[model samples]
Target: MLSSLTPIVCGIASLGLDHVKLLGNTIEQIAWQKAGIFKHNVPAIT
Candidate 1:
């Protein structure tokens, strides 16, 4: 998941690299995966 909670646990900004393998070689694919973290009515940063 691409939750802000991830960075909170790691103490570092998320660069979306961890899903590199899972996302294959497409920016669209990565974005689709990251979008899963967006919660309805909750604000997201970057």
Candidate 2:
């Protein structure tokens, strides 16, 4: 079992560009995917 909405800190360092770049994914799209892990009341450092 996992705790949901526990207000944990999340940090995103980098999104692999060289690999996924060939897939035709835009930088904004990749940023969104990385930022999607953020939750309300949680501190996220990108």
Candidate 3:
């Protein structure tokens, strides 16, 4: 038998105002951009 497991990972310690501004200056926009790094249907604990 074979089994698979996915481990939780953390990236970008923090997203500063400058970074958010570069991404369009809104929390929602920044979140959308950062969310691009993860796979679809996977649980995220932000």
Candidate 4:
């Protein structure tokens, strides 16, 4: 359902925003968090 999808979308967006905010302090952590946000088999640059 659309309601169920909302949390998934919000989680992905949160990971991305958190990754950016953490970049200045920790590059490795950002990499891990970013990987969590991305989908496998899909090409992305971030």
Candidate 5:
């Protein structure tokens, strides 16, 4: 699952309650989850 995505640049197309089921509760939680895509020392563009 994108294991080579070292310098992950997730230019999120959009965000909404559509994935509420998968994201669990709270938007902050969802953001935190998505943010896990980042690398330990690498930088994220967006």
Candidate 6:
């Protein structure tokens, strides 16, 4: 699971994988969920 990915770069690629699902199924929600890994003041790339 990418739950351990701490670099905090969010993408929409995996959102289509059957094992992963985004309720809103929108790029925005996927990015938002992926950004959950963000650390204080740390820069992230989407």
**Each prediction's TM-score versus the true structure:** 0.52, 0.60, 0.45, 0.34, 0.54, 0.40
Q: Report clashes for each candidate as comma-separated counts.
A: 0, 0, 0, 0, 0, 0
lDDT of 4 by residue, 1-46 (tens): 4364333332323333345655534666665655675555445553
| Local distance difference test, candidate 6 | 0.53
Best by TM-score: 2
Tens-place lDDT per residue, model 6, 1-46, is 3467554543334444343464446666655676576676556554
Off by over 4 Å in 3: 1-16, 41-46
Local distance difference test, per candidate? 0.59, 0.71, 0.61, 0.49, 0.63, 0.53
Residue-level lDDT tens digits of model 3 in 1-46: 3236553553543555567656868777777787676755555555
Q: How well does candidate 4 score on lDDT at residue 38?
A: 57
Question: Per-residue lDDT for 1-46 in model 1, tens only?
Answer: 6665643321123546566788645766777766776666556677
Candidate 1 lDDT (Cα, whole model)?
0.59
Q: Model 3, residue 18: what's the lDDT?
A: 67
Residue range 3-39, candidate 2, lDDT tens digits:
8857579888877665465433777777777777888
Give model 3's TM-score versus the native structure: 0.45
Error of 4 at 38 (Å): 1.6
Residue 15 local lDDT, model 5: 52
Off by over 4 Å in 4: 1-25
Candidate 3 backbone overlaps, count: 0
For candidate 4, which ten residues in a row score worst on lDDT? 7-16
